[model samples]
Target: MNHGSQPEPPLDTPFGDWLRWALVRNGYDPEERGVQRRFADASGIPVATVSRLLRDKGQPDVGTCYALGVTLGIPVMPLLVRAGHLPPEALEKEPQPTERPRTPTTEEEALTALGVIDETDRAAVKSVINALTAKHRQEGTS
Candidate 1:
């Protein structure tokens, strides 16, 4: 993941920022050489499209956002919201009178339920989860 000497320029748009963060979270350094092509191949998006997105040169379609999310193991809703294809309110849950709300059973589910859509926040939460899981495993072994 060595990106060499050139630093990555700041992503001006929210979607661009999120895409860059998600790429890093998924172990793809945006600054690394051939990252755009690699990510495009992984996500099944065209290399040119991926390049434009990585460079923050154009807007992405909903399908592109969903494809990237799937490739990154992130929920597509957040991507859609960040890409402006959907409003922030789209992520809010509506009450269902017939069914009771179920608690989140996994880290991803918990993050989604808590609306922790920011990639930075998601990474922090994942780090804490990993630390806690490791500590618990150690304690159990002891």
Candidate 2:
């Protein structure tokens, strides 16, 4: 992995161990250079929480796992599934249809066609569209 990139953790690896592995993959040594503290700062996670997470001390909440996934540049679902926040089925790739697909037309439909997999990410896309639409309205551009 590159200096800023994280490796995908093995499926059998414990979540806490994977968290530490992510630090190493990103070129940060949690023990030597206060990587957890830096991660806390970068991720807005508390130091104590990061410490406990590293030590596998407690079950992390969904939001915490989501934040960690965002910070680590990894898909949040796998972590969420591992943490029991989401079901394994949620991560399964849907089968492609054998027939023709419906095409989207309107802006909203087109946005929906982007195929955002996560509800949070989908909401974020909608929020951005709403904000941009409002700005366009203010500027008399749309």
Candidate 3:
């Protein structure tokens, strides 16, 4: 029996669209990423069958992923990553932590001297500390 052209029912409807959107964003031109056609021709599975499979959802379980990979000339692991079932390895890079500004001894000294003049000096010291920290952050970012 011919499986109609309608998309397969999925556990999460948005997931399909989200996957499709990611595929497109990742430079898989719809024209070139003809996964169904590619799978069908390579696997000897009918295009209609592949099309029906694409329509179904629920994270493209491992077996389904393997079937498509076998047909599409893609590795199954990467395909799962594309669908967000697997985290993309490219995203695993540790972002270099920015170094913050060193607390300025000069500012600390100035604040200490000011504290001697004003009995209520805690606020001024805190303000200086905050300023140094902010400067350090800004310098590291640049």
Candidate 4:
């Protein structure tokens, strides 16, 4: 519970170790002054909870892991697995394929994909595309 400027002890558990490494990798120094409070504020976690996690005193719940992952710009599955909430096998599960938006195949499609609804804007875009295509063709023939 010492919140002084002294460097905190190294985390001992696997999750805690990983969290510390993640923090450092994301440009946070756990041992720096007010780092716990900063991390708690950034992750929307309580200061006590963050401190306890840093000390390897308790496991983080799913919400906590999600918040930490968002704040750390890292994936949440690893956090959950490391916190012992999910089995290591969970990491091996194949991710479901997300449906990707279809690519625009024409100038009109590109303008629509960009949500350009104004007729004037569409005309301008077409003009630019035409100019680029003409330039490319001229260059190819050179």
Candidate 5:
């Protein structure tokens, strides 16, 4: 596996259905969850769509698959590849770079070049930093 990529698994038959079951079962609660709520929360998919998928098994579509993967915190590539929806090599391909590595004139210039914001609305940046710092301080020296 690459630094950022996970190995695509070879899914057994009934993989897609099983995946949904696994995700929901892993987070399952006996009385606290309905299929719509669990499916939406687990897959980041719309609850209605989840219901539609459950109702119309072949109609869930890409959005449903993608949402389920995202919500489950598993990459879509692995699932698709495993399920024969995508070629295995597709998962290993790196995204095309839009530009070359930037070369700064000096070390300090390079460090300074890495800015969190650039003409973007950053009103809450300080607040987030402060909150993070407080959290870190609370955690102490690990």
Candidate 6:
């Protein structure tokens, strides 16, 4: 059976950049989370494969493309396009409106703000927060 058309990128375009954008937009920071390693873990693809892909070493097969899309919460078609799997006509149509990304929760904001501090201090703060949270849970309070 024929797989659907895959969008093709020009030889000059760095498809890995597309993947990076998708990952960042979805809150998977390579810098913070060991990008390739975490993505490999999440997508069940090999770390070497992800590394090669990031390095623009090869094109992913349909299944790999799908895995990356699912992991990053991005539309697979654009990824397919970047992978040169579809015809140019596929992207000629109008784009769909996507939901706005959810705002970070107060806790997320606080933790992110804390992330700017020294790593040891941040760890200590996180430990304190965890202990307080556990105590609150024990007391049956929100």
lDDT of 3 by residue, 25-48 (tens): 434433455754654665665667
Q: Highest lDDT among the candidates is held by which one?
A: 4
Residue range 19-129, candidate 4, lDDT tens digits = 677777666789899998998988899999988888888899999999998998878887787787887788788365565667899877888999998999999988987
> Over the full model, what C-alpha lDDT does candidate 1 score relative to the true structure?
0.77
Query: Over 4 Å off in model 4, which ranges?
Result: 1-13, 98-142
Per-candidate local distance difference test: 0.77, 0.78, 0.54, 0.79, 0.56, 0.71
Give the poorly placed runs of model 3, Cα more than 4 Å off.
Answer: 1-49, 56-58, 90-142
Compared with the true structure, what per-residue lDDT tens digits does model 5 show for residues 1-142?
1112323324543554545454444464323458567657655777676655544344445665576567767677666665556776886673657656667885345445666353342435556656888998899942
Clashes of each: 0, 0, 2, 0, 1, 6
TM-score of each: 0.56, 0.58, 0.29, 0.58, 0.41, 0.52
TM-score of 1: 0.56
Please give the ranking of all candidate structures by lDDT, highest first, separated by commas: 4, 2, 1, 6, 5, 3
- TM-score of candidate 4 against the unseen true structure: 0.58
Tell me which residue pairs clash in candidate 1. none
Q: Model 2, residue 56: displacement in angstroms?
A: 0.6
After superposition, the stretches of candidate 1 with alpha carbons farther than 4 Å from their true spots are 1-13, 94-142
Error of 2 at 39 (Å): 1.0
Quote the positional error of residue 121 for candidate 3 in Å: 62
* lDDT for each residue of candidate 1 in 78-136, tens digit (9 for 90 to 100): 67767777777777853356667788998788999999989999999999988888998
Pairwise TM-score winner, candidates 2 and 6: 2
TM-score, structure 3 vs. true: 0.29
